[model samples]
Target: MTAIYSIFGRISETIEKLAAIHRLLPWILAFALLLPLPQILSALFNDYYIYLANKICIFILLSVGLNIVKGFCGQVTVGHVGLYAIGAVSSALISLHFGWSFWLAFPIGILAAGLAGIVVGLPSVRLEGAYLALATLGLGESVRIMIAVTPLFGSSTGLLSIPAPTIGSFTFDSYTNYYYLVLAAAMIGIYLSFSILRSATGRAFMAVREDTVAAAVHGVNVTKYKLLAFVISALYAGAAGGLFAHMPPGYIHHNNFTIIEMVTLLLMIVLGGIGHIWGGIIGAIIVTIIYDQTLEFYFYQPLLFGLTMVLIVIFMPRGIGGMIDRYLATKKFIASQEEKSNAAS
Candidate 1:
């Protein structure tokens, strides 16, 4: 174990050194690798994998946003899927009924979701824990129920033939073409998330999460930061929803944004690490891939997922991200011990 930890520590140190050499080196490398993913998937497997990749990107946005409110701000919001539904339906309706372009509808969809976030966050000022979770869960279910029953939302038939995004004569209707659009948005969302997480607002969010009363005592407006977190998260969900609505063969239904979907999002964050920065991204990718792979076991899928969550909670409460952090910490400790021993010699 000692030898293995030493080796891993050396490797991690080398990577850290490389990353430190350029401010954007990790990002540049990530993009360079990710940019070719669609092509690689298309060649190695099929366009179906590309579609899965696109879904992963969308879920990445959703998971990241959820992490902001749940992990960072300590807000227990289960209505994020509802916001996603609102964004999808709003964008689809605007394009289909109002004859507006996707560009116009997308922002409107995001705004509508942001407003909904404010409505959802309003209750958080008075509620906590289970009460807050129940409130948000009810809110989320209500959104789905409304879409299921309302004619304007296409009821059970769902909205179909939603227009694909276009720039001049170029329509992003193909899997590979649309992948670029989603990829760009996902990357921007991640970059912005990092930016916000490093700012004063992010510090406020962490403070609020750690202890609301202490944060308040320190002059942090807990209510303001909590609401801001929700709104920001809603924006990310809205954008993801809009993108999903405008993707190739654009169609969305009430069933698409159900409690099951919410659970999946929860699983993503849990698997990644509740408060870890990369938790959402890592969780989204892993969950999506596992889901795709387990399609054949549809009946048992939920059971497996539930079991996995339970095990993770019991055995690895901090999650995969936490595990990685521990590994890195162990490696650093080993390296420092070696350095101290060498100096003594």
Candidate 2:
């Protein structure tokens, strides 16, 4: 693990150096590098791996978005899945009913989710702790119930035959072809997330997280920032939902956005390290792979997930990302001590 973290540290340092030349250069390079992943997976394994990769990408967007509000902003929101459902349903409905192209419908879906985010975030203005969680959870579950009961929202049938994105003579109708779309979105999502984390707005979010009263005292506009976090997070969820709805299978059900899915999403962030920037990315990849591997034991999956969350919280409270942070901190400390000793000698 130490060696792995050391390697990641070197990669991060390299990227930081690239940022000296241009901020977007590293992301562009990453996107370019990942562009060939579909072909590579097809060669080494199978197209299924590419499919898995796409799912991971979507989860990356969702988990990372959730992290912004839950981790960075320290808001207890169990209703983010509700916002995701809003995006998916809105996008699918727009494409199916209005005959809109994926390109147009996607952003509209995102807009709808962002609008709903304000409603979900309203509770945070006055509530805290378990009360806030319960309120959010209620909102999230209500979305699923409404979708389940309303035929216009797909009811028990779910939205189907959602159009895949296309341009000119090309169509993204296959898993390999669709990989680029989701991959690009996921990369952009992470880049923007980093931008938020480094900005004055990000600092205000941290301030609110640390202490809402203190943040308000400091003229940070705690309520506005809190709502802003949810809205931004919802936009990410919206993009992810639109992508998921338009993926090869091109279908979305209320079951896909249920509490089980929400719990799984939470587990990803928790297992990765709550406040770490890479927490969602790491957790999404790990949890998705694990869930895929354990598909045969479907009956026990929820129990397994619950147990895993419990064990991680109890034993490895900081999680893998947290451990990596500690390792880097220790390494830096050791290096500084060695320099001091040599200087004295």
Candidate 3:
């Protein structure tokens, strides 16, 4: 454990030094390095792995956004899937009905979800704890029910044949081709998440999360920050939805957004470590892979997921990311002690 922490500490220091050269330098290099991921996945495993990668990327976006509200702002929202549904359905409908390109429809879908986020967040002003959870859950379930019953929203049929993005003659209509589009979005989403977490807005959110009354006392405008967290989180969900809707095969059903799905998302953040910066990213990758691998045990999947969440809460309440954070903090403190001892000598 100490060795692992040392390795991570060294790597983190390297990254900080690189970041110091230019704020975006590390991210730019990361983007460039990730550009060939699709080809590499295809080479090592198979084309199906590329599809899984795309799914993971989308989940990354969703989980990260969910973290902003549920983790950062300490708002218990289960209706994030509803915002996701709005984005996917909105984008799909625009492409199917108005014949808009993915480029245009994507942002529109995101906008629609962002608007819905305000509605979902409204209850937070007066609610807390389980009551807030129930309100968000109700709102989320209502969206799924509306989609399931309404023929215009595709109902049981679902929306299909959503167009892929294109750049002139180049069409991102294949899994390999579509990987770049989603990968870029996921990367940008992560970068922005980190940016938000480090900004004054993020501190205000943390203040609100840590203590709503205290935040208000400090002139934090707790209500506004709470709402802003949801809005920002919704934007990420919306972007994820748009991408998922337009992915190859381009079909979206009401079943895609459900209580089970919301639970899975919650598991991601919980397993990764809620409020930790890399929690969503780690949880998304691990859970997505685990879920994909356990597809054959469909009957037991939910049970397995539920059991895993419970176990994690009991044994590792802080999660893998939290453990890592502790290790890093410990390593830093030890180094400082050594430095002081040497100076005393």
lDDT of 1 by residue, 137-235 (tens): 999999999999999998999999999999999999998889888988888888788878989999999999999999999999999998999899999
TM-score of each: 0.93, 0.97, 0.98
What's the C-alpha lDDT at position 28 in model 3?
A: 86
**Model 2: per-residue lDDT, tens digit, 111-210?**
9999999999999999998999999999999999999999998999999999999988799999998998999999989999999999999999999999
- On residues 248-344, what C-alpha lDDT tens digit does candidate 3 reach at each position? 9999999999999999999999999999768788899999999999999999998999999999999989887898899888878998999999999
Any idea what lDDT model 1 has? 0.90
Screening candidate 2 with a backbone cut-off below 3 angstroms (N, C-alpha, C), the clashing residue pairs are none
For model 1, name the residue pairs that clash: none
Query: RMSDs, each prediction?
Result: 2.4, 1.1, 1.1
- lDDT of each candidate versus the true structure: 0.90, 0.93, 0.92
- Model 1: worst 10 consecutive residues (lDDT sum): 1-10
